[model samples]
Target: MKLRPGGFSADRVLRKFLPRSLLGRSLLIVLVPLVLLQGVALLLFYGNHLNELSRRLAGGVAGEAGFMIDEIDRAPDMRSLIIQETDRYFQFTTVFLPNQVLRHLPPPDAPGPVDDDLARALGQEMHRPFNVAWNTAPDFIRINVQMVDGVLSIDVPRKRLYIGTFYLFLIWLIGTAGLLFGISALFLRTQVRGITRLATAAEAFGMGRDPGPIKPEGAIEVRRAATAFNRMQERLRRFLAQRTIMLAGVSHDLRTPLTRLRLSLAMLPEVEPGEMAEMTGDIAEMEQLIATYLSFARGEGSEQAVPTDVAMLLEDVAAAARRAGATIEIGAPEGLTATLRPEAMRRVLTNLIDNARRHAAHVWLSAAIHGRTLRVSIEDDGPGIPTSQRETVFRPFEAASPGGTGLGLAIARDIVGAHGGDIFLFDRPGGGLRVVIELPA
Candidate 1:
């Protein structure tokens, strides 16, 4: 499929924020909604349930303090008696100051929900103005109520205004979500692993390498895809085998009659030289056409892939071309090795170089490594192919040049494609054709 230029750039931008792999994307699909649900639940619990509970707890503490203040005011002579009784029963300590008055102080910088609730509750219950200090000490809350001539100081323990159940609810919510996400990740990874194996097998088969038996696994859809791939692989192999056999038989049968005709022409006495030359030339062209067809049909034979030094192979091709009176320049790095069918790859390179030599006086060959791919370019100084005809020239029997069988580029492309590589044609920098071959390292 062809993509618009802007489509590719937009996809890249989207990928920057999205996960790149199937497993990660699947995990995101599962976890995002779960996190949002948990967030909403926590918000509701804090807004309604936790807030109401804090207010009630604060009100209870304020009620106890108000009762103590009223008892001390009604019987000022028994202030010590009221203090002793309240301390014994309610866990509060109250002191009566006769001469000094207490001033109101500012609230703390970091006040808790309990502090706000307590302030409101105390404001409604007490008739006189008061000051509430939450940070007077770490373990207690202090409330000072102004009296006509003195002040009433009350100290209450911090635990009286807090609900222990709030913390328990939070722990349960977070711990359960973590456990659920972990389980989901484990399940997702197992399913994704099957797809990974299937992709690897498909790639190896495309490169003409043996991919051992593929067993179906994962979800039903993934299994279906694997089954389809296996069937396609078998059908392609059978078709190629049948074609090769048919071509071999045809080539053998045609050559026998052509050989007898050549012998008959040679034995004829006083044959017209011009007519005889023409007949022989036609016979020679027929033979050359048959040979080219046979070569393309056989697909360079069934050769196993092995590690080969690409630089040395190029050097040998250049040396051979030079001996044939072709000026060829090769630029490649040392010790560049790749797994390949050496004979087939050599044929591909030789065909490209020969085609270049036929049109240009000087040919240039260069290689470079880009990421995980090795790129090799062959350039010539001849007239470059027009963009419209570049793809058409790769078809069998479709030649760009006169008197050519037109199978050179087609055969080269087939061989390169079998090795999971691609060949592209472009205009040379100065004025000719440039062919680029890209192979995975």
Candidate 2:
């Protein structure tokens, strides 16, 4: 990965903030637009619709107050009657304080656009010194105006300026956004679950375990991927079966000639015992070579993985090698279990041990677990392979030692790869060769 300044990778930073799962990302895809739409809707409705309506209402109230002022100025004697009529008709309360002088007051702090709009409307209509009190009462706004005689105070009902439609609209907007988000989350989870199952099946199959076929589900693309995975599994299984059959036929045909040669060598008359023995050994070697080729080409076919006690498996392979007259030593803990194809794994260990014993008297076999990985080593005192040729030794027909078919390590590597593991060769600490196998625990 490339790093940005301060040793932080740009992709790493993005991953830290980004949702790691498909379901979360898919829900974000739905929710981001929903939230943006809600914001735009609120801005348009409150800014245009609610604002204009509140301004008009404020103007109407300001007009009524101006008319009251005009009537009082026209006939000061009927001021009491005008106040009574205005209070009765407009659902307002009026009071007069005699000989009171009005002072210039800065506009009060406004709770919303209504207060600012109302003050502007009042200035336009009343055309005199005035003050608007917003929080003196919960349901009423107080407006005091300067008159020739004294100050006239009026309380206007707040409901006239506010229809309260915005609150209802806000509630609907939030409720719908939440409902849509919930639906999106639920839908995305189902789609993501199908992909998760497909990935899990693929991993299991890669590890040489049978996960069977998964049912195609969810969206079209997801269902098609599942179907394709199932088909791939079937095709691979058929291909392995066909290869095994063909290999078996080839091995039989090759062995028939070797069998006839062995019989002919046994039936030869007046032949030197040593020559006959040499011929017999050559024929036997050819037969063994054919068997080894077949084993290598067949690989690990149709072997379902299962949990095996690896400690016990190692002990078994070691004991078998000892029975075959090869000295073996082991180091493993009790109950060291791992998922593997036991027979295939045994073949791999046997090949490595046999190879080591061919060139060295003593062989060491050990198994251990490291984190989520299982590691096995076959070490010997044989002359280790050269550094340059270590990798080349794994290729077929490139034997690491004399008289080796070179298929032993190749077959071992094939089986280990099938188990989603790897085999490596290295120089041993005591000046010998060490072959290590690492697998998922």
Candidate 3:
């Protein structure tokens, strides 16, 4: 088998950040810039809008103040008329006659302006705009003092525009944050899903299973990775095919000559009985080895999928073993079925049980359902393989007995693997070796 690289797949890399994965991090990177851009846009937009509104406000206030000033100038000698006329056009109007004695100021909540500077400006016949705020409230009064032969002060409440703008900006900031979070989540989810598919496919392929071709979808980088995986899968298939063909040819060629020699040994002289028996045994072992090799080389046939009764198949194999004088037990659920090539599965199970009977005094066969998977186990009552050598024992040419051909386990593994299943040797809980097989249900 080919070695896997040290680093994880792209999908895994993204999964680490968004959903708490890299994709999420990338989305955040893009979203932060967008949020900043929106903030700047809102600032500029509010500034332009407020500047225009401020200009109009200033002009209107000045016009209203100028008219009041003209009326006051006309009635310089009549203080009572000035106050009465001012009241008709202004909501808040107050006039204080020139006094030699200064009076103590009223408390902060008073509606009228109490600024001494504005009072002096009015008396001096000076015209200018000045801001004076109430201590009890956020209200700021803009006083236009006019001293045209007499004291006159007009007050207009300001600060409305700024307060309204504050509330508007607060709403806009909240809305922008929500929008950024939603868009980032959407983009990150899409990227992460594609990466996840690629990772799953890569893992299946690495485990010596033929995972179907990866569809190139999603971002450019993801598509590129899928393309690379497809190429690797194709190369692996070609390599296995070539190896299988080579082994098949060698097995066939070698076995033909062995067959001829075995037949010739039967015709050997009866006087040479000891030599003949020894030669026959050697030839028989060689033939067995050749047969095992060929079986491994010839993988499962290209047969269409069909449903088969697993319970019946196990029963048949068990009966055959019993007839051969092997102590084999069978256990399976009623009406259990599986999608597979029946002949191939039969051959694989037969080889497993046959090998077990040869090594162990008795064998127990059992089947069980595990969620979406079907599990089968063959356990023996003899000494199991060493813990450290379990993996090596499944390899070809690594047999416990001198005359045993290790190809039996290898062939069984290949057949099961082709069906998207696996065979493993484990130490039985009680004792001896246990061969467990897992197949998709």
Q: By descending TM-score, how would the candidates be arranged?
A: 1, 2, 3
Top model number, lDDT: 2
List ranges where model 1 is wrong by over 4 Å. Answer: 1-16, 93-112, 127-138, 142-154, 254-287, 300-307
lDDT of 2 by residue, 249-365 (tens): 999899998999998878889899999989899998998999998898888777889999999999999999999999999999999999999999999999999988888889999
| Each model's lDDT | 0.87, 0.90, 0.70
How far residue 225's Cα lies from its native spot in candidate 3, in Å, is: 2.2
Q: Over all chains combined, what TM-score does candidate 1 have?
A: 0.83
TM-score of each candidate?
A: 0.83, 0.74, 0.55
185 Cα displacement, candidate 1 (Å): 1.3
Model 1 Cα shift for residue 118 (angstroms): 1.8
Model 3, which residues run further than 4 Å from truth? 1-194, 203-212, 266-282, 296-320, 334-348, 371-374, 386-392, 410-430, 438-441
lDDT of 3 at 103: 28
Ranking by lDDT: 2, 1, 3
> Best candidate, TM-score-wise?
1
